[model samples]
Target chain A: MSNPKEHLYQKTAFDLVSGFKNKQWKAAEIAESFLNRALDTNKKLNSFICIPHESILDHATLLDEKRNSNEDLGSLACSPIAIKDILCTSGISTTCGSKILQNFTPYYDATVVEKLKDKDALIFGKTNLDEFAMGSSNENSFFGPVRNPWNLDCVAGGSSGGSAAAVAGQQCAASLGSDTGGSIRLPASFCGVVGVKPSYGRVSRFGLIAFASSLDQVGVFTKDVRDSALLLRIISGQDSKDSTSSSNFVPHFLDSLSIKKKWRIGLPKEYFQQGLDSEVRQALSQSISLLGKNKFEIEEVSLPHSDLSIAAYYLIATGEASSNLSRFDGVRYGYRASNPKNLNDLYKRTRSDGFGYEVKRRIMLGTFALSSGYYDAYYKKASQVRTLIIQDFQKAFEKVDLLLTPTAPFTAFKIGEKTKDPIQMYLTDIYTTAVNLAGLPALSMPCGFDSKKLPIGLQLIAPRFEEERMFQMAHYLEKEFHVQNSKHHIVL
Target chain B: MKFDIQTVERIAELSRLEFDAQEKEILLQDLSKILHYVEKLEAVDVEKIQPTYNIIESECFFREDQISVHLSNDSLFKNAPEVQEHFVQVPQMIASHE
Candidate 1:
């Protein structure tokens, strides 16, 4: 018999849950297998900010006791999963990688965390992220940037960078990330794993700390497409708290993957334009070519206002961020300035001291955009452009079943490479941001490696609530290219 | 369109944030560059396009009127920076003579 413990870190959550359900091995054994891997390598990658090492064993033993007693256990019993720091975990410090919330412990669980607990998944640790989910690279984290498992010098892309790196580093079997813009996909591409950002409102945003309320969606990083689909199935449903949460019935994502038909994939002409790294283009071409050979029809489609997406995304996200983040003024929770002279000093000093550089910059821009004289010029204009971008996608989707594009302009850049140039850093999400503007479901899966052996990500976007269709494409492409959920093969 | 120190100070005041001189100098340049980039949005003719305030088109649903213990007062105040008795203490919003 094959030793399940030997490959526990490499196994998918799907496999782990099945093993647990069948009572093939104890849940404590699988949890310890991953705990050992996380403890050994997490220091080097800086993937985990806080690991519930003792809690994992505690939860695992309880799960095992339940199994032994013949008690009912949820679908995912004792499968270890890492959570991004942005999510609220009861009694655990949920910092959102910002000093403002440095030591804040949430009194209640985020809806997603509560859901994972309901399924009996071992909520392993809180991974790092860009402070307030602001930066494109993980460098903006209060905790140090998460290093790409493939190359230590490069970044695991942000703001979901840590979750991506931890999974790629094999520190966890799977992880959850919140994607505002390309936080999940960029890092997933950088680290060579599967990242899925479901349709907006498909999942509850109740427990997630908001960045841009309209754009942010909780997603997952896993070894393969189905694991992502399985996790999505477990987490997505309407919640009483999140009024925006869709009342649409959740679909059976894994079973629905059996739909086999020729998918007419649309290739955006804008994405292949200048500035796309030649190597990335080659990897994208090869992945699409493999799909073409597999009987999937490929055609060139255009999103005319695509180039304008990044600018609109920044204006809209920052504007929303400025409003959403204004609640953090050292009153009810989080870091408070000592001995404030008055209320106004408390607000100014508390924010000035609490927020990091990039976060401050975004807040400044957002404040400027939303400011009276400039609102009609900056925020209003950007909102109008966002409408145009949405229309562009709407028009394109009418003719195509799915759209394929490069997830990022290039593979992981060096940690400090573009930190100085905020504009250059923002360009990393060039291809992926527009999808969020249109509020579509998209998946980023590994296609191939660059000359430097860094992984390239291929993004497949579907019309709203069409994640199953997108996953069908991702699964087929992953099989054909043999790149779905491949491990980073990087030694810490 | 011209992002200057006055503009920075104005926005910073509005944003309730303060930055040192060195940081302010950097913010001036960075904010100017970003605003310049956002200038491209002005070029796109969106005469009749309505701004998308919310992406998902769903009517807000009001829950049945109810009141219950969602969280205890102590748990809600667990992370408060300053709590007096059962209430969150904050700096005086208005100067008061006692």
Candidate 2:
């Protein structure tokens, strides 16, 4: 057991694939090891929503047979990865952490899933998330909140909370997650791992269950930056299924890490504001100083519209969410109430019973914003302001190549702490929501720890198609900050 | 930004969501607070600003409408509670104007 654990855990996907190709270790052995580890961790932390053990084993056996016969293997061959429940996995129940689609199994694989298949990647399981990817903490999940491996009492920041927790807990090498308003980075921050939300459309959103169509993006969480680069390399591409996906040539993300120069990393003043925990503030300052010591020039900048991001995101995301979610009218696919005599009752009962409270709240708010007389007053006004927010980033990027901030206002709070108050929960995204709203690339890497020993992340944001800058800077900071030491470790 | 029960009811209808009286009361307060905060957008001077819709650059992307042999009918209706004639069945949509 320990031998398989040593062979599987702490190894990057690329490394595992290489080992499988060289016949150093059988893919079946690696797959069984990861499965056992995942099951063991589930007893400690409920990170998985669905585990495709039998299927994964079957896939691994085939890969092993091919490898033994000296057949060609793709980049992610036999690599163990977890899919966030938001991404549709054909034949697997993709709940989106909501009761409405609780038993729903997508008929076709999402474009990302197809890409992973092309790479011969073994999807280990589907991790939990906030219902419809709505909340900042995993507590909103209908499957129940995923506990942080660091401290079971604390939350794994959501809606990608489960993905982050799984990686932090060493359940899987890497996991794919969706970020609408900092879902991926927040949990990565809380779990003390590395997660990146690519520039909008960098990764196709074809099969990702829409949270906020404009805001939602698929990202990856990994224990190391190299693995994230590898996973993103395979996943990011243009697809006809997603109209928003970019046709621009995808960059060699792995090559981006090798470029070494004295880069200018920005320190945004707006992020270091009131309500930010003092320890987190100090940790970010110290991390900035460390970066400066490493010859990376740290410039202080300002984004005045940063504070208004949460409000704007809520309005815009909910407005779009209200529209996208209208498809689940107890009519087509998904859970329908027992029996409805009329169309109104059908729509009403299915929605009321299917959606969780937070989801309903956002939908109602979104619906109100786009209502007949209120469209111009709310949704239209928000669109205009959103342009201004984008302009703020455009102007700021003119002065600095990349901006930095604390991933969240504080470290992981106790589970159920903010579920009672929706506003307080929304506040958790104060540092992260803006980057999503602006549709820029951002990466959260472990920077330091708070007094209570929870990990704090230093978020790095770069311009559109400038993911290389983020990767290089993050790699530099990873070495400079030394975030992967035993201190960041969690033993399940 | 001031919201009342009457406004909440209307908003719920527009959103096509079903909220009971208790949920409506709670939402009235929450929605009022959110509206008040978002009302700051009105403070910004946008005399000639055009409302932006789509952000990503590029347009006119069209896909050939070829029917690809994808998931089987059984798999498609696996999660549906009601199905008929290889299609999902639901109550007839009574159009608002109907």
Best by DockQ: 1
DockQ of each: 0.83, 0.60
Candidate with best lDDT: 1
All candidates: CA RMSD in angstroms? 1.6, 2.4
State the lDDT of candidate 2 residue by residue for A1-492, as single tens digits: 225546475677878888888778898888987888899889668899999889999999999888878888889998888999999988888999999998788887888988998888998899999999998989999999999988999999999999999999888889999998999999999999999999998999989989788888999999888888888878998888889999878888887787567777778888987898998898888887877776777788888878778888889999999999998887777889987877888888899899998899989888888888888888888787788888889988998888988999899999988877777889899888888878899999888888777899889999988898789888877886773345655767
Clash pairs, model 2 backbone = none
Runs off by more than 4 Å, candidate 2: A1-7, B64-67, B92-98
Please give the fraction of native interface contacts (Cα pairs under 8 Å between A and B) kept by each candidate: 0.91, 0.63
Candidate 1 lDDT, A59-133, residue by residue in tens: 999999999999999877877899999999998889999899998999888899999999999999999999988
